[model samples]
Target chain A: MKRIKSKTAIVAIVFSLAGPLSAGESLPIRNCTWCHGSSAQGFSTAPRLAGQREKYIENQLLSFSAHIRDNPLSQQYMWGATANLSPEAMRDFAAYFSSLPPKAANDGDPQLAAQGRAIYELGIAEANVAACLVCHGPNAEGIREIPRLGGLSHAYLKRRLEQWGQGFHAAAEPMPQITRALSPNEIDALASYLSFVAYESLE
Target chain B: MKVIGLRLALPAAVLALVLSAPSRADEMGGPGFSSQELRAKLDYCKTCHGLSGQGYRGYFPMPRLAGQQPKYLENQLRAFYERRRSNPVMANVAHALSPSMVAALAAHFKDLNTNPIGGAPKEPVALGKTIYELGLPEANIPACSACHGPEAKGQGEIPRLAGQLFPYTVKTLGNWSKERGQGPAKDDTSFIMAATTHNLTQAQVAAIAAYVGSLR
Candidate 1:
């Protein structure tokens, strides 16, 4: 896996140098694909960009550029990456990434999935947690500006949920409030359930 | 020994009275929820319905409850619980709420006043205003103002349309029959809308939605 990652990084670097001449697109795909993985399926800390809602991706890019999405990792990497990008370039990137087919991360604890599904669908009314499906969709295939939550990596999902609770991304409305209602255990369950969800199951 | 027994009896009677007071208050139509519970539930509701009950646009548009008629809100909550309304999300939400909680929530939303989260097109507003004030006689449409009031502030079981989300109103009006009055028993209030919702053309629906959505 380490060897393959290094090879991917080398190829990404090569492509970054030769990309503009061959593709005619000024925005370098390597800039995102470097950490997001060759297929944009997400590596380690970086989230999967593939099959994300176009508007959501665009909005996030704008947020990152404005430094509104101030999570540690975002500030460390995405802030500089999006700083120089124009609106058209952001839209193009969003369109390109959103068109790619997504694959489920499938790297979460299977035992917790049922509990997560319950939280996702019905919510814990006693705890005052709102049903995620109300806005995220039944299958978690988000619409318009809502980010698709299905098939994301457990680590990425968990970190993001935790960050919202920690008050990192204050600009994302309702998320901080929503995550505040979630306990550490609930977050684990949610992240686990979402990781194994395949987008094709919607059919 | 007699004095000690009498003192014990007095204390026991006071304890019983204190314990019974909450149930008695519930029987008298007071809110079953504590202030904290009510606040938490309201926050849960605002998570999708907008922080100020101005409504929100999500995967499905959550309707504005701000300044809505308490009677209408209560009836809708009942409809959801009874399966008269076909919304699965609302059904689950309504199922969790007791009658007193429903009443309390409705009353809370009834007092909220917020501006519309405007996104409707400006072009068809004139046509919308015309239809709102004076219905198309040829189409058998009565003026919305006739029932919803000139200011669009509804009374009793009639819902207030002022400051409602444009997309939400459009979707609700468009799929009224499909979403509402789904139970074995008939819903009288929803029945009145059956004809009105059916008669309006797509363009007319957009116009009316745009107009009411812009109302303060």
Candidate 2:
């Protein structure tokens, strides 16, 4: 795992040095596209950044730089990818990516979508799960520093929720507290529902 | 032989009395809910209210529950269940709580003495303080201290204004008549503030909200 990270870091550094040859020009889009996908649609383990909240992307980039987002993938990939990025460059990257239209992953169980919708909208009050819409918005379009959860892959959404409870990234306050109340079934329902949410891009 | 039988019967009677005793003070809900169960419920409340019950800034502002009067808390819970208060999420939450659970939850939040969350604008604070203490007599607004208490800690069903979330207070005061006192049959305590809330302008409400929200 360490070897792979070092190699990725070396390639990232080389890419940074070889970038498009002018300050304030287009961000080295290729450097990110290599793993984030040619269209920035997220490939393999990478989370989709397209049409995400600009402030959220900026905050996450800062989190990477500060080593505050300590999730395994964030530690392995994003730390190196963002390590050499200047604050101006990070802001530019975030702004550029946030404007692009995002596609729904649509990769969760179809049968679970209804249950997920119920949980997201109403929450399981008897179980003490607060409605996700209270903070995430009715359509799961996040505000400000909160990332948009709509149309993210089920695996990505599920893992992020589970990781908070597992004590991975402690910096995202209230998430650890919030997600702790969700049962495993609730998580699956939420992930499934969110995966199917139709994209509503705010250009 | 009869004396021996009497002696044995006396011990049996004492054992029966011990078995039928009311039980320990802290063991609420008897065998129904453990201390762990109550703690879980408290954690749930804290998720939006903040870990220390200091309030939080979600998409919709969640009010501070720390240092709230237990009577006020319990009344609000019952109000939510009874539809006298009009928050859909809270209504659902209140519906699920039993009377004992409501009492336990209310008492639990009342004792938490966390600091104010503190996000109100500083510009209006002085004006807010003046309004809070002195009121706009020309406007016929009674001093808030008269009802909310000097420190805004509140009494009985009035609810504590101290350390409340600015937005929550603003929304509550702004939408007082629309949201609260809706059930015609149950007039409730919210009506006491209806005329006051009605007479206060938006600026005055903001000022009062900012002032009280800054209290410890």
Candidate 3:
């Protein structure tokens, strides 16, 4: 009888521990966590969905559905992930992921941070580059539809910036125009600087 | 000795010519930006100010410069340069612009007639229209139309309020005393709206902003 009681307790403990993951099983969030980190912090190719702007994530999901955000990685992974995703599902997923706490990638050259900060704050006016802070916020904490740029991975940020310059997300106005103004060195600096930024909470 | 002197003279002359070449646009023509230079500067302005100078909602609301009065534009630019307007971004931007460049930019933006990027809450629009047209006499506020013109297209140093961003107008009027009239030594036209801004309630200000912001 004591052995039977211990088995039931163990089963209860397992179920309790598995609650969050099982919740995703019903919501298809498991598919996302497969590419994105288990905690939605992001993995190799996928970006951190945690602490992202819900609106921005929704917009990107819609963009992916429409094939508007045609970057190579986006085309490969996100396109399939977001395809046929219902509006309700999109909203739920965006809300869930964005609510999660984010961790900084912290994978950038430390030396280039200052130069990146300068460009992000003031922009290279001679090059007609607008300040990134004007839209991205003081600490790169975005508001409303603007995605939170702080703590995004260096590789992801750099690629997005480069892709914009290369004419991938043409419909994402101001970014394409803005990125066109950024030089290669400036892009590298900005990516490096943004990668190291750690935020305590969601914007 | 003659050959060495000739070589040195040639290189020195070349260096002098290169060094003396006009580095800035204003240097090319006495106190004026050349056409190419003006075009480049306009592009810079548009990067933040919108392609048509219609203004944009960035981290901060970039005000609508399109169809703005040239005098107002020039004054604001000078205000930024002089620290009367305490905006770090605009201060740096304005410092780079010379008098002629300012003039050229002002003229360029004044000619633009883009549609408003309307995204204000429409529920209070009617109340806003009323406040804009008929001021609260009890509160000692004059009808905005009286000075801003019936259409809110301001004259001279007064700014054009039509199609201005709702948030920008609200912020400007709400923080009028703080942001503008900062230079006690140099009181400018921003004082014209000081009493009105002070008298208007937050709701009233929002209404007025919403009304004028949606106009053309």
Of the true interface contacts, each candidate retains a share of 0.55, 0.53, 0.49
Q: Interface RMSD for every prediction, one decimal?
A: 14.0, 15.8, 13.2
Interface RMSD of candidate number 2: 15.8
What TM-score quantifies how close candidate 3 is to the native fold? Answer: 0.85
Query: What digit string (tens of lDDT, one per residue) describes model 3 on residues A60-160?
Result: 89999988888889888888888889988898888777766678888878899999999888887766778899988988888778988888899889999
| Candidate 2 lDDT tens digits, A62-130 | 999898887899999989988999999889888877766679999999999999999888778889888
TM per candidate? 0.85, 0.84, 0.85
* Model 1 alpha-carbon miss at residue B123, Å: 1.8
Which residue pairs overlap in candidate 3's backbone? Answer: A134-B59, B128-B207
List residue ranges in candidate 3 displaced over 4 A: A1-24, A201-203, B1-34
| CA lDDT of every candidate | 0.84, 0.81, 0.80
Q: Residue A166 lDDT in model 2?
A: 78
lDDT of the structure predicted as candidate 1: 0.84
Please provide, for model 3 over B6-51, each residue's C-alpha lDDT reduced to its tens digit, 9 standing for 90 to 100.
Answer: 3244236424433454453234344554555655677678778886
Among incorrect, acceptable, medium and high, the docking class of model 1 is: acceptable
Residue by residue across B172-195, what tens digits does model 2's lDDT show? 988867888878755578887887
Q: Every model's DockQ, to 2 decimals?
A: 0.26, 0.25, 0.23
Candidates in order: C-alpha RMSD to true structure: 10.8, 12.3, 11.3
Better of 1 and 3 by lDDT: 1
